[model samples]
Target chain A: MTIEHSILGVIASRPCTGYDIKTEFEHEGAGMVWGVSFGSVYPKLKSMEEQGLIQNYRTETKGRMKKMYELTPKGWEALHKWLGELPSYPSIKDELLLKLSMWDRGRPEDRQTLIYHMKNRKEQSQELLDYYLQWPQNGHSSISEFGMLGIQYVQERLETELRWIEKAILQLEGEPQPPVQDPYDLIPKQQERRNLAINPPVITVHPESSTDEDRV
Target chain B: MTIEHSILGVIASRPCTGYDIKTEFEHEGAGMVWGVSFGSVYPKLKSMEEQGLIQNYRTETKGRMKKMYELTPKGWEALHKWLGELPSYPSIKDELLLKLSMWDRGRPEDRQTLIYHMKNRKEQSQELLDYYLQWPQNGHSSISEFGMLGIQYVQERLETELRWIEKAILQLEGEPQPPVQDPYDLIPKQQERRNLAINPPVITVHPESSTDEDRV
Candidate 1:
């Protein structure tokens, strides 16, 4: 859904109330892959309303107020007909890889902390997969099939990522411990070391092996 | 440092002008795993200047003008502070996954097209890795280390994705042919047939035969 810009595409298929759209979102497997919360949806709907991409009407039904939404003709045209291009592949902005880039700059202990974090994240992904699989498949069968495919796709990819993370951990674990460098012992080639202002070198240490390093 | 945001963080360590910054970005293994263009960088620098995050001075040397850039105190503060936070993990959002998700909606020809696209993408990733390895590794030791790490990571991940693509192609290839359904095949039970619209009809065919019925 995120890949296809399908949320808008799906909504544009017909006029629907907010609840109806939410039902479609959950049942059609879109939610399984491109997650959205009520918090996210309502705001987006309101914004779309403001943009005149969609319109809404309020009605009283069985003593309850219902707000229904519909794509304007322009919005429908924009969704199915316009097809403005977006980047084909999604780019990652992951921070863990950045930490790995700077891992050598830190103490051996600091690097180990990053490894632990990745291990924990991998475990959580597996747990989520298990929970997703346990969902009952008793109703909305077509939607269920679609939802299952999306879930399976995510789970399989996560498993692959775990394999990478495990390999990375192993590599980091096998690396020789970085030797501590003493600022006083290593002098500059031309400039007098004393002439440069040296901030008290705070060494990052392994969170487990060196408790003092974790004071912050 | 797409994953780490480390490229920019490292740059913020000292003030240098745009050209100097570009050199640093290129030398730091950034181009290997991630990319930034003069178009992106110049605009960002201009924005940052407006935001007071960076300051620049024009200096003339050897009859040429050079603009030197340095982080404002705020920029240095922001950089060091962000350094304490862990970098995000990388994620791949392959378009191939999107096409695969809607395989049931596509014609057999579409499936083959998807397979071809995946194969091409896999080959492209591999070729990129190979080209990166041929790049000269001298003078810039840390950046070279980054390049080596990036090559290893990308190559391994691409191999895993390629295996999945191969499996999908094989599965589709081995599908048993279906006894094609006709518009007027038989009189249907109104209730059951109505229910069928809510649930896609399952494909039943010889294990190795191609089937027109829904597979997903």
Candidate 2:
């Protein structure tokens, strides 16, 4: 979906200035799911206004003229139309995964570069995870219950990925194992797979992770 | 990175026709990781040839002309440069998550609509997971060790998400709750968080999942 929908969604909740929208993106859960730049926000806002999806009014806040954008009837109509449609598959594009897929093609020194990158990636996820863990303590103000769900989902995903990266780093550091197994080649029917998916095994975190206490 | 890099990378390994690359995307792990349309592949190939990263020539097979694309030295240089740069964070845009985040704003019936969509999504992932599970039996031919790694990663992620959806469905089905806890708000530093990440919890799939025997 276009950023216009997100912009319209935000305006639907509450009208805000451009800077408010930009800051909301950086610090909010929606921004985590959809990446947008500070530069793209204004151009999109202008275009949204041009399309009559949103309208802006001038406001004086602290001696500065600010343009506040709010959803028009057309914008509300557009958002409802989008919300009625089925969500498409999640669009995932990660350079790290792409680079890792092409691992064998790079030079030996490039391996070192990759390890360094994962280490950095590990650090960032950890930082974010820790910050998310703080939400329970911080008084919930602006976030809706669904927003809280989104935060928890991010925390769980980050926890899983952090562990995956550790395994990947070890695999890269040592001789990678090749897949070897005798044929057991037959996929189950749709109903059977659903039964299997619904009754999944217990979820656990790393033994040493800070959130190990939350392990189920 | 552009699909140009992926095309260049594929051609770097060996020259192939546009149809070959297009088919590779449809059936390969790379395609699952990066979604591209059949329509997109030809236009990208044309632009890459114009930009001098790839060169194409006609070859007649079964009285049909096929344009074969091969990477130029400049293409190799470009691919290497991209590989050298630090990988960026993964870009994710999921309509499901966006719709779910706006759950409070949607009509009550939208909840049922969402669960239906997630069920379809689950079915698709199950189908793909079952397909990947067949890789061991099929004599590994075109896939490298890293490709196998990508497959396993995909399988693991799909497994985790499937379970998450189960909980989410139940949560959606039941009463929605609010957050309430005494504050203990503090984010850890870089070093401590890294140690926590490395020692993450064990991942387990549902008991009913077809891949139960493989769960570790």
Which one wins on DockQ?
2
Give per-residue CA lDDT, model 1, range A1-216, as digits (tens). 352244454444344676666666564443243435667678778877787767788888899888877556555444433232222543444455555554433322345566676676667656655654554343322322222334455556666766776776776667543222222322121112112212333555754665665557
Candidate 2, which segments miss by more than 4 Å at Cα? A50-52, A108-110, A176-216, B29-31, B38-40, B50-52, B108-110, B179-216
lDDT of 1 by residue, B111-203 (tens): 355456556655665665564454424322333232244445555555565566566556555653321221332212222332343354666
**Model 1 bad stretches (over 4 Å):** A1-4, A8-87, A104-109, A128-153, A171-216, B1-7, B10-16, B19-64, B70-77, B86-93, B103-109, B131-141, B144-151, B173-216
The candidate that wins on lDDT is 2
CA displacement after TM-score superposition, residue A69 of candidate 1 (Å): 6.3
Query: Residue A22 lDDT in model 2?
Result: 72
Please, what are the lDDT tens digits per residue for candidate 2 over residues A1-216? Answer: 367777776666566877777776665653265756779899999988999888899998899998998666676668767877877777677777776665544432356777887888888878888877786567743445555666667777777888888987887787754424312211112223223333444555654544635546
Each candidate structure's TM-score, on Cα atoms with residue i matched to residue i, is 0.58, 0.74
lDDT of 2 by residue, B97-204 (tens): 776665544342356776776787778768777877776456633454555556667777777777777877777677755433313211112223223333444465
The CA lDDT at B114 in model 2 is: 64
Note the DockQ of each predicted structure.
0.12, 0.15
Judged by whole-model lDDT over C-alpha atoms, candidate 1 comes out at 0.49
